[model samples]
Target chain A: DAGVTQSPTHLIKTRGQQVTLRCSPKSGHDTVSWYQQALGQGPQFIFQYYEEEERQRGNFPDRFSGHQFPNYSSELNVNALLLGDSALYLCASKINGGYEQYFGPGTRLTVT
Target chain B: AQSVAQPEDQVNVAEGNPLTVKCTYSVSGNPYLFWYVQYPNRGLQFLLKYITGDNLVKGSYGFEAEFNKSQTSFHLKKPSALVSDSALYFCAVPRAGSYQLTFGKGTKLSVIP
Candidate 1:
Protein backbone atom coordinates (compact mmCIF):
# COMPACT_ATOMS: atom_id res chain seq x y z
CA ASP A 1 0.00 0.00 0.00
CA ALA A 2 1.09 3.57 -0.66
CA GLY A 3 2.34 5.28 2.48
CA VAL A 4 1.73 8.84 3.58
CA THR A 5 2.45 11.45 0.90
CA GLN A 6 3.16 15.18 1.05
CA SER A 7 3.21 17.86 -1.63
CA PRO A 8 5.79 20.47 -2.68
CA THR A 9 8.96 18.62 -1.78
CA HIS A 10 10.64 21.99 -1.16
CA LEU A 11 9.48 25.60 -0.89
CA ILE A 12 10.92 29.06 -0.40
CA LYS A 13 8.97 32.06 0.86
CA THR A 14 9.79 35.55 2.09
CA ARG A 15 9.01 36.99 5.46
CA GLY A 16 5.36 38.11 6.10
CA GLN A 17 4.28 35.78 3.31
CA GLN A 18 1.87 32.87 3.63
CA VAL A 19 2.29 29.32 2.47
CA THR A 20 0.30 26.11 2.35
CA LEU A 21 1.57 22.55 2.50
CA ARG A 22 -0.50 19.48 1.76
CA CYS A 23 -0.45 15.91 3.03
CA SER A 24 -2.18 12.64 2.17
CA PRO A 25 -2.18 10.12 4.97
CA LYS A 26 -1.53 6.44 4.63
CA SER A 27 -4.11 4.26 2.93
CA GLY A 28 -6.11 3.35 6.02
CA HIS A 29 -5.31 6.08 8.55
CA ASP A 30 -7.92 8.51 9.82
CA THR A 31 -5.94 10.76 12.17
CA VAL A 32 -3.42 13.24 10.83
CA SER A 33 -0.75 15.06 12.81
CA TRP A 34 1.80 17.70 11.87
CA TYR A 35 5.31 18.20 13.20
CA GLN A 36 8.15 20.66 12.72
CA GLN A 37 11.77 19.57 12.66
CA ALA A 38 14.28 22.37 12.94
CA LEU A 39 17.90 22.00 12.05
CA GLY A 40 19.78 19.67 14.40
CA GLN A 41 16.67 19.00 16.49
CA GLY A 42 14.03 16.36 16.85
CA PRO A 43 10.51 16.70 15.54
CA GLN A 44 8.12 18.83 17.58
CA PHE A 45 4.38 18.43 17.58
CA ILE A 46 2.42 21.20 15.87
CA PHE A 47 -1.14 19.93 16.04
CA GLN A 48 -3.34 16.93 15.32
CA TYR A 49 -6.54 16.67 13.27
CA TYR A 50 -9.34 14.14 13.43
CA GLU A 51 -12.85 14.20 12.08
CA GLU A 52 -12.09 17.51 10.34
CA GLU A 53 -11.45 19.24 13.65
CA GLU A 54 -8.25 20.11 15.41
CA ARG A 55 -8.06 17.86 18.43
CA GLN A 56 -4.79 18.86 20.06
CA ARG A 57 -2.30 21.63 19.43
CA GLY A 58 1.22 22.30 20.57
CA ASN A 59 2.74 25.59 21.73
CA PHE A 60 2.71 27.07 18.25
CA PRO A 61 1.35 30.54 17.62
CA ASP A 62 -1.90 31.38 15.93
CA ARG A 63 -0.06 31.93 12.69
CA PHE A 64 0.01 28.16 12.25
CA SER A 65 -3.26 26.47 11.34
CA GLY A 66 -4.44 23.40 9.45
CA HIS A 67 -7.42 21.71 7.83
CA GLN A 68 -8.40 18.08 7.27
CA PHE A 69 -10.71 17.16 4.44
CA PRO A 70 -13.24 14.35 4.46
CA ASN A 71 -10.95 12.17 2.39
CA TYR A 72 -8.34 12.24 5.19
CA SER A 73 -6.02 14.57 3.30
CA SER A 74 -4.76 17.56 5.29
CA GLU A 75 -3.21 20.98 4.71
CA LEU A 76 -0.94 23.05 6.90
CA ASN A 77 -0.98 26.83 6.59
CA VAL A 78 1.51 29.24 8.06
CA ASN A 79 0.98 33.00 7.92
CA ALA A 80 3.39 35.89 8.51
CA LEU A 81 6.26 33.50 8.24
CA LEU A 82 9.52 34.31 9.93
CA LEU A 83 13.03 33.08 9.38
CA GLY A 84 12.61 30.77 12.35
CA ASP A 85 9.69 29.17 10.59
CA SER A 86 12.12 27.60 8.15
CA ALA A 87 12.14 23.88 8.87
CA LEU A 88 11.05 20.49 7.65
CA TYR A 89 7.31 20.02 7.96
CA LEU A 90 6.44 16.40 8.67
CA CYS A 91 3.04 14.77 8.32
CA ALA A 92 2.16 11.57 10.14
CA SER A 93 -0.99 9.48 10.27
CA LYS A 94 -2.39 6.56 12.22
CA ILE A 95 -5.63 4.78 12.80
CA ASN A 96 -8.06 6.40 15.17
CA GLY A 97 -7.10 4.10 18.05
CA GLY A 98 -3.71 2.92 16.94
CA TYR A 99 -0.40 3.82 18.53
CA GLU A 100 1.92 3.67 15.58
CA GLN A 101 2.00 6.67 13.25
CA TYR A 102 3.42 6.38 9.77
CA PHE A 103 5.14 9.49 8.37
CA GLY A 104 5.45 11.12 5.00
CA PRO A 105 8.65 12.27 3.31
CA GLY A 106 7.89 15.79 4.55
CA THR A 107 7.90 19.26 2.98
CA ARG A 108 10.90 21.49 3.45
CA LEU A 109 9.86 25.10 4.13
CA THR A 110 12.45 27.83 4.00
CA VAL A 111 11.51 31.36 5.07
CA THR A 112 14.06 33.66 3.62
CA ALA B 1 2.55 14.04 30.88
CA GLN B 2 5.40 11.67 30.02
CA SER B 3 8.86 12.86 29.00
CA VAL B 4 11.83 10.98 27.64
CA ALA B 5 15.56 11.69 27.64
CA GLN B 6 18.50 10.72 25.47
CA PRO B 7 21.53 11.46 27.62
CA GLU B 8 24.10 11.02 24.93
CA ASP B 9 24.41 13.65 22.27
CA GLN B 10 26.44 11.34 20.01
CA VAL B 11 27.41 7.66 19.99
CA ASN B 12 30.20 6.24 17.86
CA VAL B 13 30.78 2.55 17.34
CA ALA B 14 32.89 0.43 15.06
CA GLU B 15 31.27 -1.52 12.27
CA GLY B 16 30.52 -5.17 13.13
CA ASN B 17 30.41 -4.34 16.81
CA PRO B 18 27.27 -4.37 18.90
CA LEU B 19 25.64 -1.02 19.47
CA THR B 20 23.38 0.49 22.04
CA VAL B 21 21.45 3.78 22.00
CA LYS B 22 20.09 4.68 25.40
CA CYS B 23 16.71 6.20 26.25
CA THR B 24 15.08 6.83 29.63
CA TYR B 25 11.50 7.81 30.35
CA SER B 26 9.54 9.42 33.19
CA VAL B 27 5.94 8.49 33.64
CA SER B 28 3.48 7.60 36.32
CA GLY B 29 1.90 4.45 34.85
CA ASN B 30 2.54 2.23 31.86
CA PRO B 31 4.70 3.94 29.24
CA TYR B 32 4.31 3.62 25.51
CA LEU B 33 7.67 4.38 23.96
CA PHE B 34 8.91 4.57 20.38
CA TRP B 35 12.19 4.78 18.50
CA TYR B 36 12.65 6.51 15.13
CA VAL B 37 15.63 7.05 12.87
CA GLN B 38 16.14 9.98 10.52
CA TYR B 39 18.62 10.06 7.70
CA PRO B 40 19.99 13.36 6.48
CA ASN B 41 17.17 15.73 5.48
CA ARG B 42 14.61 12.93 5.64
CA GLY B 43 11.62 12.36 7.81
CA LEU B 44 11.62 9.89 10.70
CA GLN B 45 11.32 6.16 10.09
CA PHE B 46 9.72 4.16 12.83
CA LEU B 47 11.96 1.58 14.44
CA LEU B 48 10.24 -0.09 17.37
CA LYS B 49 7.97 0.53 20.34
CA TYR B 50 7.27 -0.82 23.81
CA ILE B 51 3.69 -1.18 24.90
CA THR B 52 2.56 -3.79 27.44
CA GLY B 53 3.78 -7.00 25.95
CA ASP B 54 7.17 -8.60 26.28
CA ASN B 55 10.06 -6.53 27.50
CA LEU B 56 11.95 -7.07 24.28
CA VAL B 57 10.44 -5.38 21.22
CA LYS B 58 11.93 -5.97 17.81
CA GLY B 59 11.49 -3.48 14.99
CA SER B 60 12.75 -2.61 11.53
CA TYR B 61 16.35 -2.75 10.24
CA GLY B 62 17.61 -5.38 12.64
CA PHE B 63 16.88 -3.11 15.58
CA GLU B 64 15.46 -4.08 18.94
CA ALA B 65 14.72 -2.36 22.23
CA GLU B 66 14.59 -3.63 25.80
CA PHE B 67 12.07 -2.07 28.14
CA ASN B 68 12.94 -1.87 31.80
CA LYS B 69 10.20 -0.82 34.12
CA SER B 70 12.36 -0.50 37.22
CA GLN B 71 14.96 1.61 35.47
CA THR B 72 12.38 3.44 33.42
CA SER B 73 14.52 2.93 30.37
CA PHE B 74 13.87 1.76 26.80
CA HIS B 75 17.17 1.31 25.02
CA LEU B 76 17.61 0.52 21.34
CA LYS B 77 20.08 -2.21 20.54
CA LYS B 78 21.50 -4.10 17.60
CA PRO B 79 23.57 -7.26 17.42
CA SER B 80 26.05 -5.88 14.89
CA ALA B 81 26.40 -2.35 13.59
CA LEU B 82 26.59 -1.40 9.96
CA VAL B 83 27.92 1.66 8.18
CA SER B 84 24.46 2.43 6.84
CA ASP B 85 23.09 2.46 10.40
CA SER B 86 24.58 5.88 11.05
CA ALA B 87 21.74 8.31 11.56
CA LEU B 88 19.94 10.48 14.10
CA TYR B 89 17.90 8.36 16.51
CA PHE B 90 15.09 9.80 18.56
CA CYS B 91 13.11 8.37 21.49
CA ALA B 92 9.54 9.48 21.88
CA VAL B 93 6.53 9.04 24.14
CA PRO B 94 2.98 10.25 24.01
CA ARG B 95 1.89 13.17 26.12
CA ALA B 96 -0.57 12.33 28.86
CA GLY B 97 -4.20 12.30 27.76
CA SER B 98 -3.22 12.91 24.16
CA TYR B 99 -1.67 11.28 21.11
CA GLN B 100 0.94 13.98 20.55
CA LEU B 101 4.44 12.51 20.84
CA THR B 102 7.13 14.23 22.88
CA PHE B 103 10.43 13.41 21.30
CA GLY B 104 13.85 13.41 22.90
CA LYS B 105 16.58 15.72 21.67
CA GLY B 106 17.87 12.68 19.72
CA THR B 107 21.06 10.64 19.76
CA LYS B 108 23.32 10.71 16.74
CA LEU B 109 24.68 7.22 16.05
CA SER B 110 27.74 6.89 13.84
CA VAL B 111 28.90 3.43 12.95
CA ILE B 112 32.48 4.04 11.87
CA PRO B 113 34.24 1.59 9.60
Candidate 2:
Protein backbone atom coordinates (compact mmCIF):
# COMPACT_ATOMS: atom_id res chain seq x y z
CA ASP A 1 0.00 0.00 0.00
CA ALA A 2 1.21 3.45 -0.83
CA GLY A 3 1.66 6.00 1.92
CA VAL A 4 1.03 9.72 1.73
CA THR A 5 2.97 11.33 -1.14
CA GLN A 6 3.83 14.95 -1.97
CA SER A 7 5.17 16.63 -5.09
CA PRO A 8 8.15 18.85 -5.77
CA THR A 9 10.76 17.73 -3.26
CA HIS A 10 12.00 21.33 -3.23
CA LEU A 11 11.04 24.74 -4.59
CA ILE A 12 12.40 28.26 -4.87
CA LYS A 13 10.25 31.36 -5.24
CA THR A 14 10.64 35.10 -5.17
CA ARG A 15 8.64 37.61 -3.14
CA GLY A 16 5.12 38.29 -4.40
CA GLN A 17 5.15 35.02 -6.33
CA GLN A 18 2.73 32.16 -5.87
CA VAL A 19 3.43 28.48 -5.27
CA THR A 20 1.35 25.35 -5.26
CA LEU A 21 2.18 22.16 -3.37
CA ARG A 22 0.40 18.90 -4.04
CA CYS A 23 -0.31 15.92 -1.81
CA SER A 24 -1.72 12.45 -2.35
CA PRO A 25 -3.35 10.91 0.67
CA LYS A 26 -2.35 7.52 1.89
CA SER A 27 -4.27 4.54 0.61
CA GLY A 28 -7.64 4.06 2.35
CA HIS A 29 -7.43 7.53 3.90
CA ASP A 30 -9.96 10.32 3.46
CA THR A 31 -8.89 13.31 5.54
CA VAL A 32 -5.98 15.52 4.54
CA SER A 33 -4.17 18.15 6.60
CA TRP A 34 -1.36 20.56 5.85
CA TYR A 35 1.37 21.86 8.14
CA GLN A 36 4.24 24.28 7.93
CA GLN A 37 7.56 23.57 9.65
CA ALA A 38 9.87 26.53 9.89
CA LEU A 39 13.52 26.15 10.60
CA GLY A 40 14.22 24.81 14.07
CA GLN A 41 10.52 24.60 14.98
CA GLY A 42 7.75 22.09 15.09
CA PRO A 43 5.12 22.04 12.41
CA GLN A 44 2.25 24.49 12.73
CA PHE A 45 -1.14 23.48 11.43
CA ILE A 46 -2.28 25.19 8.23
CA PHE A 47 -5.65 23.62 7.63
CA GLN A 48 -7.55 20.37 7.18
CA TYR A 49 -9.81 19.18 4.37
CA TYR A 50 -12.57 16.60 4.46
CA GLU A 51 -15.34 15.92 1.98
CA GLU A 52 -13.84 18.51 -0.35
CA GLU A 53 -14.34 21.29 2.19
CA GLU A 54 -12.01 22.95 4.59
CA ARG A 55 -13.08 21.82 8.05
CA GLN A 56 -10.62 23.64 10.30
CA ARG A 57 -7.96 26.23 9.76
CA GLY A 58 -5.09 27.44 11.90
CA ASN A 59 -3.95 31.01 12.61
CA PHE A 60 -2.75 31.56 9.06
CA PRO A 61 -3.33 34.45 6.73
CA ASP A 62 -5.72 34.45 3.80
CA ARG A 63 -2.77 34.02 1.51
CA PHE A 64 -2.76 30.36 2.46
CA SER A 65 -5.50 28.18 1.03
CA GLY A 66 -6.08 24.52 0.17
CA HIS A 67 -8.28 22.18 -1.87
CA GLN A 68 -9.17 18.52 -1.53
CA PHE A 69 -10.31 16.55 -4.53
CA PRO A 70 -12.78 13.73 -4.55
CA ASN A 71 -9.95 11.21 -4.79
CA TYR A 72 -8.61 12.53 -1.47
CA SER A 73 -5.62 14.24 -3.04
CA SER A 74 -5.02 17.80 -1.85
CA GLU A 75 -3.19 20.94 -2.85
CA LEU A 76 -1.83 23.83 -0.82
CA ASN A 77 -1.55 27.28 -2.44
CA VAL A 78 0.35 30.22 -1.04
CA ASN A 79 0.08 33.64 -2.67
CA ALA A 80 2.21 36.73 -2.32
CA LEU A 81 4.90 34.66 -0.73
CA LEU A 82 7.35 36.29 1.63
CA LEU A 83 10.72 35.25 2.88
CA GLY A 84 9.12 34.02 6.04
CA ASP A 85 7.02 31.66 3.97
CA SER A 86 10.12 29.62 3.32
CA ALA A 87 9.69 26.36 5.19
CA LEU A 88 8.94 22.68 4.82
CA TYR A 89 5.31 22.02 3.95
CA LEU A 90 4.16 18.63 5.17
CA CYS A 91 1.03 16.71 4.20
CA ALA A 92 -0.61 14.17 6.46
CA SER A 93 -3.60 11.90 5.92
CA LYS A 94 -5.78 9.79 8.19
CA ILE A 95 -9.07 7.97 8.19
CA ASN A 96 -12.13 10.10 8.87
CA GLY A 97 -12.47 8.91 12.47
CA GLY A 98 -8.96 7.74 13.13
CA TYR A 99 -6.49 9.39 15.50
CA GLU A 100 -3.25 8.34 13.85
CA GLN A 101 -2.13 10.17 10.73
CA TYR A 102 0.47 9.15 8.16
CA PHE A 103 2.72 11.90 6.83
CA GLY A 104 4.40 12.49 3.50
CA PRO A 105 8.02 13.36 2.94
CA GLY A 106 7.01 17.05 2.56
CA THR A 107 7.78 19.78 0.04
CA ARG A 108 10.50 22.23 0.89
CA LEU A 109 9.49 25.78 -0.10
CA THR A 110 12.23 28.33 -0.12
CA VAL A 111 11.07 31.92 -0.65
CA THR A 112 14.01 33.95 -1.80
CA ALA B 1 -7.51 26.17 23.02
CA GLN B 2 -5.06 23.31 23.25
CA SER B 3 -1.27 23.28 23.36
CA VAL B 4 1.72 21.00 24.02
CA ALA B 5 5.09 21.73 25.58
CA GLN B 6 8.31 19.73 25.25
CA PRO B 7 10.40 21.18 28.07
CA GLU B 8 13.78 19.99 26.94
CA ASP B 9 15.30 21.06 23.67
CA GLN B 10 17.55 18.00 23.57
CA VAL B 11 18.16 14.81 25.55
CA ASN B 12 21.27 12.61 25.69
CA VAL B 13 21.38 8.95 26.66
CA ALA B 14 23.83 6.11 26.32
CA GLU B 15 22.98 3.01 24.33
CA GLY B 16 21.04 0.37 26.28
CA ASN B 17 19.97 3.01 28.79
CA PRO B 18 16.37 3.89 29.42
CA LEU B 19 15.29 7.04 27.60
CA THR B 20 12.68 9.61 28.54
CA VAL B 21 11.43 12.65 26.66
CA LYS B 22 9.19 14.93 28.73
CA CYS B 23 5.97 16.47 27.47
CA THR B 24 3.15 18.45 29.09
CA TYR B 25 -0.13 19.56 27.55
CA SER B 26 -2.98 22.04 28.06
CA VAL B 27 -6.48 21.56 26.75
CA SER B 28 -10.02 22.61 27.53
CA GLY B 29 -11.52 19.15 27.25
CA ASN B 30 -10.24 15.60 27.33
CA PRO B 31 -6.85 15.61 25.62
CA TYR B 32 -5.94 13.69 22.46
CA LEU B 33 -2.21 13.40 22.71
CA PHE B 34 0.31 12.03 20.17
CA TRP B 35 4.01 11.44 19.70
CA TYR B 36 5.99 11.70 16.43
CA VAL B 37 9.61 11.27 15.45
CA GLN B 38 11.45 12.97 12.60
CA TYR B 39 14.81 12.30 11.10
CA PRO B 40 16.98 14.84 9.30
CA ASN B 41 15.16 16.55 6.40
CA ARG B 42 12.13 14.32 6.76
CA GLY B 43 8.51 14.70 7.75
CA LEU B 44 7.21 13.77 11.17
CA GLN B 45 6.54 10.04 11.63
CA PHE B 46 3.72 8.88 13.89
CA LEU B 47 4.93 7.15 17.00
CA LEU B 48 1.82 6.72 19.10
CA LYS B 49 -1.32 8.38 20.39
CA TYR B 50 -3.33 8.48 23.62
CA ILE B 51 -7.02 9.08 23.06
CA THR B 52 -8.78 6.98 25.67
CA GLY B 53 -8.37 3.79 27.66
CA ASP B 54 -5.05 2.72 29.08
CA ASN B 55 -2.81 5.44 30.49
CA LEU B 56 0.19 3.59 29.24
CA VAL B 57 0.08 3.26 25.45
CA LYS B 58 2.56 1.14 23.51
CA GLY B 59 3.61 2.10 20.02
CA SER B 60 6.12 1.35 17.27
CA TYR B 61 9.84 0.89 17.76
CA GLY B 62 9.44 -0.32 21.32
CA PHE B 63 8.31 3.11 22.45
CA GLU B 64 5.54 3.88 24.91
CA ALA B 65 4.00 6.79 26.74
CA GLU B 66 2.30 7.27 30.09
CA PHE B 67 -0.59 9.68 30.34
CA ASN B 68 -0.94 11.45 33.66
CA LYS B 69 -4.17 13.39 33.97
CA SER B 70 -3.20 14.88 37.29
CA GLN B 71 -0.09 16.45 35.84
CA THR B 72 -1.46 16.88 32.29
CA SER B 73 1.68 15.25 31.00
CA PHE B 74 2.48 12.48 28.48
CA HIS B 75 6.11 11.50 28.49
CA LEU B 76 7.55 9.12 25.89
CA LYS B 77 9.75 6.36 27.26
CA LYS B 78 11.73 3.48 25.86
CA PRO B 79 13.21 0.66 27.92
CA SER B 80 16.41 0.54 25.88
CA ALA B 81 17.77 3.31 23.73
CA LEU B 82 19.08 2.67 20.21
CA VAL B 83 21.50 4.77 18.24
CA SER B 84 19.01 4.84 15.37
CA ASP B 85 16.50 6.42 17.78
CA SER B 86 18.61 9.54 17.82
CA ALA B 87 16.26 12.01 16.18
CA LEU B 88 13.70 14.72 16.82
CA TYR B 89 10.66 13.90 18.92
CA PHE B 90 7.47 15.95 18.91
CA CYS B 91 4.39 15.98 21.11
CA ALA B 92 1.04 17.06 19.67
CA VAL B 93 -2.56 17.66 20.70
CA PRO B 94 -5.75 18.23 18.76
CA ARG B 95 -8.35 20.78 19.71
CA ALA B 96 -11.84 19.64 20.66
CA GLY B 97 -13.78 18.55 17.58
CA SER B 98 -10.90 19.50 15.30
CA TYR B 99 -8.33 17.57 13.32
CA GLN B 100 -5.72 20.26 13.46
CA LEU B 101 -2.74 19.10 15.52
CA THR B 102 -0.89 21.66 17.57
CA PHE B 103 2.67 20.43 17.89
CA GLY B 104 5.13 21.33 20.60
CA LYS B 105 8.62 22.54 19.86
CA GLY B 106 10.35 19.22 19.12
CA THR B 107 12.88 17.59 21.47
CA LYS B 108 15.98 16.11 19.90
CA LEU B 109 17.17 12.77 21.33
CA SER B 110 20.80 11.75 21.04
CA VAL B 111 21.79 8.19 21.84
CA ILE B 112 25.51 7.68 22.14
CA PRO B 113 26.86 4.24 21.31
lDDT of each: 0.95, 0.95
Clashing pairs in 1: none
Candidate 1 chain B: minimum summed lDDT over ten consecutive residues — where?
B37-46
Error of 1 at A70 (Å): 1.1
Candidate 2: residue A75 Cα off by (Å): 0.8
Give me the runs in candidate 2 sitting further than 4 Å from their true place. none
Residue by residue across B32-110, what tens digits does model 1's lDDT show?
Answer: 9999999887788999988889999999999999999989999999999999999999999999988779999999999
Candidate 1 TM-score for chain A: 0.99
- Candidate 2, residues A1-112, lDDT tens digits: the string is 9999999999999999999999999999999999999988999989999999998898999999999999999999999999999999999999997778899999999988
The CAPRI category of model 2 is medium
lDDT for position B13 in model 1: 99
Which ten residues in a row are the worst by lDDT in model 1 chain A? A96-105
